[model samples]
Target chain A: MIEAKNVNFYYGNFHALKNISMQMEANTVTAFIGPSGCGKSTFLRILNRMNDLIDDTHLAGECLIDGQNIYDKSVQVDELRKKVGMVFQKPNPFPKSIFENVAYGLRVNSMGDKSFIAGRVEESLRGAALWEEVKDKLKKSAFELSGGQQQRLCIARALAISPSILLMDEPASALDPISTSKIEELMYALKQKYTIVIVTHNMQQAARVSDKTGFFMLGELVEYCDTKKMFLNPDKAQTQNYITGKFG
Target chain B: MKHTERELQSLKEEVSQMWKLVLSQLEKAKQSYFSGDIELAREIASREKRVDAFELKIDSDCENYIALFSPVAVDLRLVLSLMKISSTLERIGDFSEGIARHVIEEDCNRMPPQMLEDLQLDRMFDMLTGMLSDSFVALESENTKLAGRILAKDKEIDAMYCNSIALIDRFLSENPSFIHCGLKTLLLIRKLERIGDHCGNIVEEIVFYVDAKVLKHGAKQNKE
Candidate 1:
């Protein structure tokens, strides 16, 4: 469960997100949709403190997971990331074998013994729906897989850490439609175990995949509502115009 | 200019044209009923095929649009309403053709004028036509305000039908010689009542499209 209350974020003098307050429930898919540069990705990065890596950036307000604010000084950034894992738009697997790519998370976190890591790697791959495809090629380079398979491999790597939340930033934008569909399907499956937040430019995909949708515009949240209501009859005229493809 | 918008616009156009054609069919049916003009009855009968064709086309178009574009929100409501409205209009067209058939089968002069008056036949026919016109206007303008009046008009048609039952019984008892004509007259009134029912259906579909409210199955006809 993730909740943002009046979250205003900045990169130096530029305010990237303005008073964005939304809730992403456990075991559900929440999507952020808008035109490019509307600060959806900026807001997502703030969840796991990835924004903290940038210079001169600041956040003002609570980014709470469960009851505790993740931005609190007492909270460990590394530990926060372990609880909330992220997969980027590109599938950036390490220059390692498929098995090692998935095992990287467990190994970095010093999570388990060799047998435990191997078993967890298989389970995570199975959770990502990539295990059967790559079962015989565990030692093969991750680059040897197709774009879609590589994305799922990245998903397996993220899931290996046993994170309770998964933050996906345009995870399938670079893949073909078939691969995109597989990723979408995988999101539905993944939501049963992880609270998932996805950022997408495709309105139809948002309509199809999310339980709730937040439409962002000009660094502000224009509307946040049930996905059905958002796609069927959004409350705001700006949301209606944007989703209907009539935005000026 | 968007692809889904273009598809939805074309779907609305096709539905509107079918609606107007059904209205013409009703008009021809009314002419056949009043003037016993068999030629107008023939025209109404012939146009029934076109109405059936429109139903198939609109139904297919709605299905294809859903499959290809998967419209959401108001666009989704419009396509769904188009499907149901087209079906309701087709039924109206059928009843209109059925009325014309009754006209073709009987002599208008043989029917008792007093009985026609008692049943308020002319008044009921006019109300049905008016209801159809109101539904058409409501659908075109997306004005759900027209719904209450349209639904109320259907009750008048039903009352006329209720009055016709007794009138037919009395007419048949007094003039057993005109029993055949009386029964046919009763069927004509029943056809008008059915047309009224179809008009109510069309009005509900209009409301669904304009307001995103379901009015079928005796749902609250709360007007916008």
Candidate 2:
């Protein structure tokens, strides 16, 4: 389980998130939904310490994964990133073969011999539902694949390291409906072994894929509940108005 | 997907219009049944076509709304409840029209004041009218406070129905010569009872739209 307690995040002088507290369970999909600039992406970054790469950022309160604070100095940043992988909004595959893209993380870590790396590559590709499409053309450049397939390759790259927690920031927003649906379906399949958290602008996508949904506004966590209740009858009027498109 | 707010508001108005038509249908049918007015009965029958038309229009509109906008949360609940509410209202319209037709065909003008009072048929119509009216008011205001009270009235109608069945059976044995009118009276009573049930169904749909609670098939409003 992942938990954030009274978290207040700041970028330079700007307070991006205020006193946000939430819990996300293992092997389930949790979605964060709000308008742009709502600090959802910033919070997702905090889980893997990706914010550490940004300059002049400050954090108050504890972010815990399995009862240990990830921000603790004793924890290595590179190690934490390997355990908590992320897939960004755009499908960014390097100028290399699809096989090498999945093997990149393992190769950087020098995880095993060439044969072991190849097995892990195939396993991660199958886990992301991309193995069949790319198996025959494993040596072909990743740019040869379509936009949706490229996104899946990025996901396979993330899963290659066997991360327990996966953070996705609008992973399907740039893709078409068919491609978006493929990504959504892939999220459902991956949640069987990985705890997934996604930031999305699409309310229906959140409703369709998530087990729990959190509604944010103005950097504040407005309401968090079971997905059905959040979509069907949210307790707060602000959440209702936002979801119903009555927000002023 | 665009202009969702205006489309939702327009859908609400359309459902309200259909609601008013169904209410007027029930009221006219009740008046014709009690007064044994054949002309008014014919009018009620003719207006049944309009209720049918409203049902068809509302169903298609909801489908189109879903196709175009893909509503969620309360917007989804409103469309879903409107679909069921319109269907229930249409069924109530049918029962009311059935009562009107029975009046036009039978000689209920001589249905004996004592027998009518014993069956509480007048009180049944009064409660059914109140139930339908209250459901519309609740829907208009988007409040479920009226739902509990409206649901309670259905129980009263059910009690009257149970009492009337025994009274009608006793009357049939005593007045063998008036058997035809007695059987027709029983049929009208049954129709009124069904109207009460359908109105309660509308109340349930109202509660679902306003509070997102499903109170069907013996489910109580949790209110939690």
TM-score of chain B of each: 0.95, 0.94
Q: What is the per-residue lDDT of model 1 for residues B1-224, given as tens digits with 9 covering 90 to 100?
A: 87778888899999889988998888888878888898899889898999999999999999999898766777777888899999999999899999988878765346767666777878887888899888889988888888999888888788878888887898778888987788788888888899988888888887777777788886844552
Window of ten residues with lowest summed lDDT in model 2 chain B: B215-224
| C-alpha root-mean-square deviation, each candidate | 1.8, 2.0
Summarize candidate 2's per-residue lDDT along B121-191 as a digit string, tens digits.
Answer: 77788888888989888989988888888878888788888888899889879887778888888888888
lDDT of model 1 at position A173: 93
| C-alpha lDDT (0 to 100) for residue A87 of candidate 2 | 98
After superposition, candidate 1 runs with Cα above 4 Å error: B1-3, B107-109
Give per-residue CA lDDT, model 2, range A1-248, as digits (tens).
99999999999999999999999999999999988898899999999998988999999989999888998889999998899999999999999999999999999999999999999999999998899988999999999999999999999999998899999999999999999999999999999999999999998999999999999889999999999999889999999998988773
* Candidate 2 wrong stretches, greater than 4 Å: B107-109, B220-224
A117-168 per-residue lDDT for model 1 (tens digits): 9999999999999999999999999999999999999999999999999999
Q: Candidate 2, after superposition: displacement of residue B180 in Å? A: 1.5
Error of 2 at B208 (Å): 1.1
Candidate 1's clash total is: 1
